[model samples]
Target: MNLFKMLRCAFLLMPALFCYSQTSSGSTAVVSLEICSNESSVDLFTMLNADAVAGGVWSPSLSGGQGIFNPAVDNEGTYLYTVTTNYVTLYEVEVEVSVVDPIAATTTSTTLCSNAGPVDLIGFTNDTSNQGTWVPELSSGTSVFNPSVDEPGIYSYIASGACGTTVSEVYVEVIDTANSGISTSLSICEGSSPFNLFDALEGSPDLGGTWSPPLRNGSGYFDPQRDAPGVYSYTVGNDYCGYSSASVTVSIDQSPFAGSDAVADLCVNNGPVDLYAFLGDGPDAGGSWSPALSGGSGWFDPLTDQEGVYTYTISNGSCGMDTATVEVRLIDTNNQPNVSLAITDLSGNNSIHVQIPNRTNYHYSLDNINYQSSNSFTNLSGGKYTVYIREIEGCGFFHKEVVLLGGPKFFTPNGDGINDYWSLFDISNIDYTIKVFDRYGRPIDTFDNHSIGWDGTFNGNPLPSADYWFLVNFEDGTTKNGHFTLLR
Candidate 1:
């Protein structure tokens, strides 16, 4: 066939086919194609230049001039379609084919706290790219998620490519942080009954919180007698979002104890005594006394202060107050005893008896120190005596003074050893003058206290036995007149 008729027949059969003579410049038309791996095969002629002719064969050929780009079997390179007349190349076109494999979609899940900052959504997946777009738009405008302002739910990431479209899901969950409320303090007296710890917390707190260290009675109630006073904590939330805590400081107060009542005795003769000495054991200190003392102290003086009941009080803010009483008594030592004495004899072994209406209540003492219960004293010698009496209850002491005179009844002067001489009894230490007279009022003998008495004689002559009268003058300006028998 002629070339003109041959070209005309080719154009009617294949529209993309074209013819060129030996005189035409030889240049190849180019076309590029990017297709997914999963795409179906297509004819190479359809991908070539519309001005190109058919009856052409593709290099790296396919059946029926079809171009198949499979990621598993085909390589990314140029596939050429050529048209030649009589085996000489006339028109040619190149088709560049690229194969892309679809990306695998990913899914991830994460939990964040509501207080957390912004986070990039792309970081949640490894197989997904930053080019992906979120299904639901974020408040941050970009792929970043702000937990504080954003709602938590499943977010879809759509990534498109020549291979196909893929989807990735980021399941985000936001949890609210726990709030245990504010802390406070409270104080209550010791031994107080059931106290709830909830009353100590300040502000409106979240519910479903648990207490730490457990309350004394197991119910959140504090027993003052059993529970130790200290800090108590309340915690809320779980490990997912972390926990929150608050505290209550509990203080247990004790009542002031002044101890039991007491009694004390004070003597006027003694110095001041401490009133606290009479109080019961383990009395509370820092207490105040009612009917205030002289120096505002615990010392009491019976000589200057009146005797009555003194009360001690101790107080505190939480425990209120407490009190105890002390009864004080005063003793006077100035009361003298009314006493009477009975004397037995003036000479030799004599006895002085003392009598009092209330003798049992008083103690008797010859020497003021050594005392006895008995008032009668038997064994005695002639001397000046002072008797003392003291009250048994430490009241007072009284004394009386007396002088006892001692003498003999009579004496015999017949040269007998028993009655050879005579003198005034118990007057050896006394200075006196004596004059002796006969029964007829005649002067028989004279002597003084220093001389022996007359032995029934007058002027060196023996006189008959008779009763003699004597007048004695003592140095103390006292005179004694007595009669004595001088027997021969």
Candidate 2:
């Protein structure tokens, strides 16, 4: 009884041992069987529903004096079994099975350096123990566990280990500081007015810097009051990097004063009067005197100086000067000389004599000489002479002089008349030429002798009364051109 119990116990524990062995060795479970001597053969099947056994003869006289059967496993749980020997057989067996779970694979990245000065690898993990670690592909640096990008461009990181290396792709972009430039605005007015200049700088974070004018050294603030009018240029630059410059133009105008409608009125007896000036609006608004007038500004003289019309100008040193005019007229006093002289033909012959009427008790002189009526003068010289007439007026002598010479000659071309031909007497010493034209400058008659004159006829034909021109040339290189009228 004790032996049977021990055998039963062993039989119960057989499946547990087989299952444990299959699980430990990662293999399929085994099924055990026991056959009697009377049994010829037995079939075995797998736990996974397969036709694993076929009927066969059980031979005890086989190679090990016993036969052992094994089962094959399949995908299903149902199994098949068969027996081939009709003999005494005791079959008590245990089978074991097993199942396994599939495993999944993963990858990781690494960064070697997180901060690399100006070149920082941004947006990347810094922990090397994380899934992604940075590895620099550049020829100069090693792999970084954590990476940062400060510059722009494509960046790569590789996580390397004894197993393998994994590379992660990343792109880094960086922004740069803007360069400096300048914009300027200048406001200038017309004439001699000051202007204001303003400037604006680009990319300058703080409005603090030094400004330098063109053609000048050092840097300072720009003030228009300190500078003159012209083209002014300046440059604004930072201490480290950026620089900009601009230019502005300032114009100044200076104009002079002008006067208008200035006039002066003065009497001939009052002499010349000084002209005054009034200037118009301009930069040079003040009035001044020119030519150093004795009176004041803008003065002129007419009496003790040149007479007739006089003109003076007033200016303030500007666009143009204004002018004023003064006219002088002489007034007759009638207290001066009023002497008269005349010449008359004495006879029908070509004889002329000069006479002065009402000359009683009056001393007379011809050509600065005393003349008496008792001294009759004939064949008188032909020229201009001053006939002086003096009268004793209350111990003070009253003298009057008259010019009497070179008077016109008269002729009347009438058949029954006197003075029939025009002739000049006592003028034979002067070189003269007389020509008569019939209004068309065509010579009708010509005479070279001073004593010979025109008779108002051409080729014995009488000409109508009209004006005729005469040109006389003297031997002393003097020429006299005059016009005369012929009377019938």
Best by TM-score: 1
lDDT (Cα, tens digit) per residue for candidate 1, span 321-421 = 89998898877686666688887644456777887877888889888768899987775765457888777878677788654445555677777578766
TM-score of each: 0.42, 0.24
- The residue-by-residue lDDT of candidate 2 on 25-80, one tens digit each, is 22222332232212222232322123223443332222222233322222212121
Residue 361 in candidate 2, Cα distance off native in Å: 37
Per-prediction CA RMSD (Å): 13.9, 24.1
How far off is residue 294 in model 2, in Å?
36
Give candidate 1 misplaced runs (Cα > 4 Å).
Answer: 1-122, 125-188, 196-213, 226-254, 259-286, 290-297, 304-309, 315-318, 325-335, 339-355, 363-488
